[model samples]
Target: MLGLMQDWPLRLHRLIDHAARHHGARPIVSRSVEGPVHRTDYAAIHRRSLALAQRLAREGVKPGDRVATMAWNTWRHIEAWYGITGAGAIYHTLNPRLFPDQIAWILNHAESRLMFCDLSFLKLLEGLAPKLPHILRFIVLTGPETMPETSLPGAVDYESWLAEADGDFEWVAGEENAAAGLCYTSGTTGEPKGVLYSHRSNVIHALACNAPDMLGLSATDRVMPVVPMFHANGWCLPFIAPLSGASLVLPGPKLDGESLQSLMQAEGVTFTAAVPTVWLGLLQYLEASSAPLSTLKRVVIGGSACPRALTAAFERRGVHVVHAWGMTETSPIGTICGVKPEVAGRDAEGTLDLQETQGFPPFTVDMRIVGDDGAEKPWDGTTFGNLQVRGPTVTRGYFKAERDALTPDGWFETGDVATIDPAGYMHITDRTKDVIKSGGEWISSIELENLAMGHPDVAEAAVVAARHPKWDERPLLVVVPKAGREVSRDSLLAHLAPQVAKWWLPDDVVVVAEIPHTATGKILKTKLREQFAGYFGVP
Candidate 1:
């Protein structure tokens, strides 16, 4: 039976339109890369986006063409997203932190016709311009005065280019499921694969993110995304903020603790989201400064396992911490760990233990864990297995791949080993390849890493499986001490011994000046494993 409805297409442009019409005066603040803080409103963003769309059409960008942006999380970058999508083009975001070869490969593979980059990446673009023959033009995300001289062909400043046309054209209308954005994986395992996002999926994901159980954003709230736009469309905050009429604060190139704290304090930011490393820096800064988080209310931490100590530090300051878990394939928001009423009834320590788990999924997503035999594992909180997910926002396959990236039963393999409690809370144990098998029992590297991060003297920590003659493979702990504080192997071992099984304790502890990390800020355990390949005297 067909139902009568308006049949409005779920397009990305409509999000900006709704915001402009209903919350036109809402602020979109930015710490501009050009050495000053800039501010604008949703109405101005909508109008400029439309103008940029018209300019793109004049420049011969057709529907389905890919346009790339290697910029930070600023107002201009946000405008480019709406503008490119409004012109029916795919907005491909390139992470500037990635190596030049990887960036060139991604650009060539995507066949990006044009690129909108921040001034900071001009030299990078110039170096890769030869390899990126498909990119016809380079639009620097800056004004004419601040635009630096570049040798790349057909380059221009974004503000000047956007001024070429009036915002009189309407957004292109078509199938809601058409591709609107592209984000590549961090490629820790292999060559990076693209996760193509559709307008329909993104719109649905925004609604889920704005829900109370998720980010719980509202018009009165002011939000900041320390994560960059290149990371899963800034974890969909570019859409989530406007859709909820929440004012946004975009921190430019400066992500250090002092800069972020200053911006948040100045903007009266009430909500923010980033990885644990970011918060760790901020917490350390607060510990030294004794700064009061006067207006900050909540924070969402993800991208890796957040230590419970970090959560306690925020809660101690009256700031709520929401531990979330997701990847590029799931539109980057699979599960959020907000406390449930039933779990809230427990003691404070017990509740913090539950919060340590990546919380349950929103109604749109479904999750399950499977064993090596391809059978479903019981959600008893103790048994861990391969995590799989199926949802509208989840990717069924990688872009341009010949085969589906899913199981025969149609669930996307998350590449993470996890356990789900009977109450529906999901906890990540470790990556499938990183989990240690010692004496026929599995040991969780993530668990040990998180515990190590709880130590006051530890700045960063990682656990890797080391080859052992006795157990075949045993856990090895490597840590980086906080500045000005010295950490010892014995002290770290003693701190961890009381919390976990004796066998789960690391065989040895090594202190290092620093740990290598992936472009996305995750610990590069692959490199660590290679560095300590024979740590247990096994050759």
Candidate 2:
């Protein structure tokens, strides 16, 4: 009963092809590490990517070989991304912020044969370059003038390497299920494991994110993705932006407040996406400068819960903060903060409250919360349980893992505890490991942090479990106050008393200058627990 339709497979290279054909003039702006802003177009990127593919082929890069990139978010990185995949090789984005040993370990584990890195990260990789015996060549993403001398086995300037070939080649089309990209997690829970994304999954994720009700991107928008390409495929931005024909503004190495604001002004960026900490930094810069993001409309914040104060700050400037939720395993976008049709009629205050939740699952995703006994939980928004999902873009297992990570009935257990509302909105309670147990009860660390962030003086906050004599474990409030702002423990506790159950209040408050963060900008609660595990005198 097969239908007589064309069986053409969807590949990511065709996305760039489409952009070049239709939106060739759309600009791709990058503040390259070479110290200047380089502006190119979709047509230019496509032609250059073709040259890159040809050059890779000439360099003996074979299909299914691993090609690594240790660079920032820039046009050259995008070019490498497509060229590597276009040549039917997997694109492994190496995070430079990770520990150097971890980077070396990941590169060895993936057996990466070649690498494309920015000049800035060359020194960081120098110490481990000799150890990566599998790597055949290293193409520095810079011109010959700026390329530094390195001890990498086989190194060349990218411009010279690309010049070896012209944009006179066709992309090698592989099966849709062929691995196209690889990203490892932040290893907050354990060692970083690789998640291989097929061409099909990446193509599908781009389609889903650009849907009208999702990110709702179009050709007219000027998009800027501040999230690094090394992290979760840059949340699939490198694909989605080109597919939508939107002009791009890639914020390379300088993600500081002044640098970002300057780029936004120069480029007239209309839409952007990043984690909460990034937005917090931008907002602080704006507040300090008394500036306005005139052309910016909406910002998608994820990687951590969007603080209520941060959301309100953006709203005050007539911008919308879309609270998103995802992990590296979900192809990074499971849910976004857009209202469903049923809940669209709520009042302003009610709408604000609704947006604070993680919103509903998008079209391709299926979600459910399961109780301790493995039964489906009620959708009352009050009963929290283990969140599980199954989707086309979801990974069935790690890259080389032995076992399939799925329930017997076929759902992947997301390590989050979430509650779904009757209206179908999902609210994340906390990570399984971060939830506190007190005298046979559970408390959500996310909820406590959200409430604590509402206080005026508290710039940042994290709640972790500490041993207690009677309850086995109790909550500890770790606060980082605003610069030069006085914060008393009594006031912060008073603010939380009315919002949550009295028993759920933190045992004590400790002030610190700064909080440790993961490469993705999430609070490293594991570190916090390790540092303060015995606060209540446990072994």
Candidate 3:
């Protein structure tokens, strides 16, 4: 017999409606491309989103259709997201940093019916519009007065459409399992596969993030998510903020050190999240300018491992640093490494060490590690294995039934090799694809990369396998030094002497001007493999 419970449907529209009805005056600020700030509130967003939904429905968009957006982290983009999904259409976010061909491929593959793009991407859209046969309309997210004339003949202004519509459209009632959003993976190995998110999954993920032990969001918190909205729904902050009634500050395209710092200071932001690369820049700016990070309290770093030094630097300044881990398929938040209550009073260094792990799985997630032999390992922190997970927020399968993406047992393989301690904390060693194999022994490239990043002169580092005549394959170090800093091969290798095992040490270190990255800010190891494929060992 089922226990009686509230007949609540996890709908995306309810998030916006809740915010509008309860916290209408909360600020939603965004930086514009024209070097100015535009501010609004939950009330305005709700009204505009309703108008957008009505416009979409009037334009022949129906349930189960796909509406794509290739825009920055701005208010308009957020409206389009909720509006399209609220109208019972799937909201597909296209990463603008992807190659034009990849963008065209995703749009056509998703069979997007309409696209809303930023005005700054006019030229790029014009170049790619001809190839996107499925896209029938191109709506520029700009006002009629400022909309630039482009070669695309059928383009329309966003403000004009909103003005011509009414904010009285009712949210279409769809099943909780119905697809709400589609995000494609960066496709390091093959063509990018689509991860379809449902309204139930997205809403549940937002509620899970609101827990104090997790993201600890509140109405008083001013959040600045430097992660782009196109990237896993900005780690789901767009949905979480509205659900929690927190004030949001979107940095838009200006994610540079100085600009972000200024916005943080001006807006009195208390919590923020971004990749480690962004924090590195902000730390550099703070050090050089002697600027005080006055209002900032916590920083959540993901997309890559947070270097120990970076975490320590922020903690030294009295700021809490949380190292989270997840992928597009996990609705982006599987684990958040915050200090447990029992260890709250521990020594500073010990607590910092705990913060470096990916932390325990979030409330809605369940994690397990399986060895190469398919044996389940104990949470001893030493037994490294393939990480597999199942949760309410995790995607069961890709859009349109991609059978190979899911396992027969129903667990999603995260492609990460990791360890979980008895205390329930998880630590990722490396991606299965990036793990180095020498004489059948696995070497963690992520560990080596993190160790290399500890060196003072090393700005960033990536580790990939280089071919070896005797061992078959060994680790290769690709280093990018800080500006105007010099680090010799000997000094760099010497720094790693005491940190990692001798076998894990790189055979050679190659300094590069910059490391290539994927659209989601991950190191492009595939590119590294291609560039040094033949650099095995000398005869």
- Evaluate residue 511 in candidate 3 and report its C-alpha lDDT on the 0 to 100 scale: 95
Q: Against the true structure, what is each candidate's TM-score?
A: 0.99, 0.98, 0.97
Model 2: C-alpha RMSD to truth?
A: 1.1
Best by TM-score: 1
| Residue 314 shift from truth in candidate 2, angstroms | 0.6
Model 2, 1-539: lDDT tens digits are 99999987888898999999999999999999987999999999999999999989988888899999999999999999999999999999988888888888889989999999998887887888878989989999999999888987788999988998977899997899999999998776667899999999999999987787789889999999999998888988889988999999999999988889899988999889998888878877997898668998889888888878888888888888888888888898999888678888888668778877988767778899998778999999899999999998888999789998899998989889999999888999899888998999999898899889999898899999999888999999999998789788899999999989999999999999999998778899999999889998885
Q: Residue 477 deviation, candidate 2, in Å?
A: 0.6
Top candidate by lDDT: 1
Which scores better on lDDT, 1 or 3? 1
Name model 3 segments beyond 4 Å from true: 1-6, 402-404, 536-539
Error of 2 at 82 (Å): 0.7
Give me the runs in candidate 1 sitting further than 4 Å from their true place: none
Q: Give all candidate RMSDs, comma-separated.
A: 0.8, 1.1, 1.6
- Per-candidate count of clashing residue pairs (backbone under 3 Å): 0, 0, 0
| Candidate 3: residue 460 Cα off by (Å) | 0.7
Return the TM-score for candidate 2, rounded to 2 decimals. 0.98
Candidate 3 on 368-397: residue-level lDDT in tens?
999877778899988889999998888887
| Candidate 3 Cα RMSD (Å) | 1.6
Query: Which residue pairs of candidate 2 clash?
Result: none
